[model samples]
Target: MAKLTDEEMMKMMESADNAVTGEGPATMAESNDGIAPLTVRKLMIIGCGDGGCNIATAIARKIPDETFVIAYNTSKRNVNEIVCDMKVYVTSDADEKIVDGSGKSRAYSKDAFKLNAYKNLLETVNIGLEKMPDISYIIVCTTTDGGTGSGSSPMVAKLLSDNIDVPVLLMGVYPSMDEDAIAQYNALEWQSEVERIGVPYFVLDNNQHGMEKPKVHAAVNNQGAMIASLLAGREFGNSSISIIDNRNLYMLLVQMGGRLVAAIDDARPSSGQTLDDYVMAMLQKNYQPEPSNVKGIGVFIKGSRELLDKMDTSIPEVQKKYGNAVLRFAHIENSDSVEIAVLLTGCSEAAPRLLEMKNRYDDIVHAQKEAASVIGDVMSGMKNLLGDPRSSKRRGEAKEPDISALDL
Candidate 1:
């Protein structure tokens, strides 16, 4: 398909915005039922790489129709393959083509984003916001190992945060340890950039899930989508004693130090099972180091009113375990079963893999420096023996070997 010019793209987006706001000739469809139309706050999911696109596609499938989904990449193949509401390719100038089949060159990817990709992204997001004035959240999804995703996502997040009014949530996928050194290095670099950006983010460790290489991507994508859906306060239609609306979700996510991790347990209550037991189990099973120094905690309970009341009382005890972390509660009523979902923010334990990756990257750099020094010494010795102008060797000294006489 022919690429749309910038002017054409802008016109198309403006037209869509007009249609959405009842200012254009096009009209919105009527609701099927006699019930009033439900007004939902819109969410924009922007995926930055192959892994990110996978997660965004999964999320688009699960989120409400009002949610906007777009995927961005420098690779034409990846852009063509991903399923999203929009696909954006960050093409380079004719003189500078940036293509790495392995997706390992982060420097090139960063250049691509800075040169023109970010502008395109910002423009597209502005158009989306115009169409859906209720869009209060922007979720930026990317993997912290590949070239385009890792190199550009942090900058994109920062750009969105600085230019847009909404809260930008970063969903970073951590690469497995067994991946190549370049990926590890890229992950470390990307983490540093994200830390500098100082936005709220959640880390999904691909290695911890115990899935095989071939299946892990899909698993990661599905899990991320599920968490995002829940956080967006979408109703599951089960009985609810209390509701956590989208505004409440926005408040929880917009807190300072937005490093977050979550866990969910859905099981019938046993004789010995307690709310404390569920909370402890989630902390131990889902997160590393138990996430100390938390600033906010969100607990969503699905059970009977009695069970919900018990959990509500247990919140104080849970807060005590985390240096008096502030708490938010959501309850749903369901008989014969209990479900717990935990979202912990401002946790240092959120991105332990980033620390490991940084250490690994340092070691790799040290090794490379040592190797380069040895090569430099060897080259100096060769130059000395060859009698360079600075070496001052006598004519009688042995000369360097000449292989020109050897037969092919």
Candidate 2:
């Protein structure tokens, strides 16, 4: 699981396949370091019902080449409900400008946004299968709420999991309690259901990351931007070395912990140093790498320290394991606890390689067993509450399988 260097990855990307050394390229022919020669394929991007129309519009604008289909429930008043409000602007590289398209490649918010979100998702999948037939991937970017995101997302995940064997990654968002408790609750419910389906989910919550400023509207806008960035190939900070998108490393931070501390020009000796050098320098300046007995790299922090001090605590352990690791830290306004983010870019081959746990066949098996046990317990609880006869009747009436019986 040795992390691939940017040079190595760049070479791959420039070679036969535009791959950067990693498991990120869309096509199998291209190594992670390389990008496969552009192919015209379908990539269905789904957004939840209601305000999610805005997210769908944003996504439609970001990646223009692919055939984008957004499925949502349009029953309720949403940001998109207003006439001309959810206008999706297509970003044109011709003049480096964004302009409205002639509906051909613009945002599409259909009325079916509300008919049983999950059922609608199934219908959308069926439509895509019939229309596109040859799809690269189905990227589900939804904030689990209402019908489209909450209900349809799991169904879509299940469809991909059961029928289409593709690299289906879900970029899900969770709203804060203040935003709407109902939405928050629905998000949690959808999350649990999707987890039961066992797709590779990259989840981010509005509550986890703070905005640039304290203003409410500004924060919401920033959150939207962050989600857009993540969907547009930005990595998540909480991810392991198994998931970092190295290309994005040049410009963006995966999460709040992996902030952009410095972008040096390498004035002194650019020729001699390597990409690893730049990454290491960032870690060294911020923190000292400390080895730990537990094998796992530990980033320790004390109260009342600057960003560098917080980063210092984690670097020693990470560097010892991974040569190119970036560390960052932040202090609470009034608390003693310091938050730390350690980004490992260069894990040695000897370091036990972390496999893609979510999609592994073994993981699925384990998840299924776990889910079964949990469902058994839940059914037993239900039996206790409603009596065995009612519980048995309810079980028979259930349409979906006991998802808890499938959790890993």
Candidate with top lDDT is 1
What TM-score fits each model? 0.73, 0.40
- Identify the runs in model 2 with alpha carbons over 4 angstroms from their true place: 1-42, 74-76, 79-120, 129-133, 145-148, 177-184, 208-408
Error of 1 at 114 (Å): 1.6
The clash count for each model shown is: 0, 33
- In candidate 2, position 404 carries an lDDT of 92
lDDT of 1 by residue, 133-227 (tens): 77767899988889888888898899999999888889988887777678888877777787888888888766655668767777668767867
Give the Cα error of residue 71 in candidate 2, in Å: 2.3
Note the residue pairs that clash in candidate 1: none
Backbone clashes in model 2: 33
What are the RMSD figures for all models against the true structure?
11.9, 19.1
Q: What TM-score does candidate 1 get on C-alpha atoms?
A: 0.73
**Per-residue C-alpha lDDT of model 2 across residues 181-287, encoded as one tens digit per residue:** 34545655665676576554444344322443234333332344333333333212222112223323321222111111221121232445433344455444321
